[model samples]
Target: MDKLRKALSGRDNSDEQEEERGNIMTQTEDTPLLRVMDNSTLSWNTRVKGFAICFGVGFLFSFLGSVFLFLPNGITIFAVFYTIGNILGLGSTCFLMGPVSQCKRMFATTRIIATIIMFAALAMTLVSAFVLHNKALALIMVVIQFLAMTWYSLSYIPYARDAAKKCFGSCLDL
Candidate 1:
């Protein structure tokens, strides 16, 4: 019994040490926001799980939106679902990278314009769907949203935008 108790206590101590090691890996910044974000950071396993779940939900919403595109009065439904899915998909990165880092990367100079356009397109999609109730306009906005999002995503890959531009330019020249 005494041996078992000692082993249990040792296990507890090792767990505590592991936790301390994890905490040490997270660099603390002086800013309050950074500190708060650091404090809220999840374990690696939790972060991975959160990312997977959020991304899966986002993909499901987008697929459902596409399915609704064929039904009557479905443009509005499609727009809403698609917009929400895009938002969720974009937000899922926050789980992998803390919110502060995610926001910083999104607003970084290289991708700022694309990010802004994507956000505007997302907002306009919903506005056209619900407020204007214009199916054609909503569809147009959804296309814009997709293009903007694609451009924004490409910004993450080095020189991808330039390559895309060159490819399009060559195709147009043909």
Candidate 2:
């Protein structure tokens, strides 16, 4: 025990000397915010889960769109459009997370413009089909189009923002 104590005592003195001379970097071993951004950064496992969920959801919707596109009488075209848009939207949301939130205002305009154009085109198609007496088509189109866009935007945006904010920080010490 004496020998062990002596060894530990010697090592501690060397560390203390290094610290005193500023030759060693002192880490904040007790700082709670070392890796956490705003105290809400997710754990590694949570980030992995979020990425997996986004990828899986996007793939599922895109595959569903493909299947719906091949249905008889083109009845499922609306479903196809909706699924396609949402899949793309989800993917884009994941890609452009940095820009979607208020942190990056420059890209917000482009994101908003593209979304409006996409939804407007969808609405126009629905209107044309309804006016031409294609009730089945119009029903499929309008319901899915509106709901898919709304659902994707509502569910994905906040999630992306949170994840991005956690992964990154509003300010960097560097």
Candidate 3:
């Protein structure tokens, strides 16, 4: 009886230790959604990604726009428009990153939608660059990137606010 009790106690102590270790591990380092999750913000991943995609798109097109048009024209009205659009797109993308880093929830549909937007923007950017062969195509790419940034910001702001009210909508407490 004494020996059996000792073994049981030993096993229980080890189990408790393992649990503590696991908790420590979990507390450190977080995923894109996890930071937001702690704050009850779940839609950050898509938001950040959406913003990032836009920034990338904007930067690339703006570079092209500048190289192909602005330099030659010396910052005309069209150049200013392109610059303004690209700057807005970049700013929106940067803003999305903050919320995304805080997000903790995982929703497949949101991710899918974000992915679709990213891929579509990428394809559009390339298509416009190669096939269209005009200033309009560049303008279109800048506009699309800006739109993506706007959409991401719109989707995230509400999610962060809503998440603050509920943890994972049913899981983990923020």
RMSD to truth, every model: 10.3, 18.0, 16.2
Question: Model 1: per-residue lDDT, tens digit, 17-103?
Answer: 776786543545457665546524466668768889999999899999999999988999999999999999998877776676678
Clash number for model 2? 0
**Which of candidates 1 and 2 reaches a greater TM-score?**
1
Query: What ranges in model 3 sit over 4 Å off?
Result: 1-69, 73-108, 130-132, 159-174
The models' CA-based lDDT, in order, is: 0.81, 0.48, 0.50
> How well is each residue in 122-145 modelled by candidate 3, as lDDT tens digits?
456556555664557656765675
TM-score of 3: 0.35
**Of candidates 3 and 2, the better by TM-score:** 2
Q: Please provide the root mean square deviation of candidate 2 (C-alpha atoms, Å).
A: 18.0
Off by over 4 Å in 1: 1-36
TM-score of each: 0.77, 0.37, 0.35
Task: Give the top-scoring candidate (lDDT).
Answer: 1
TM-score of 1: 0.77
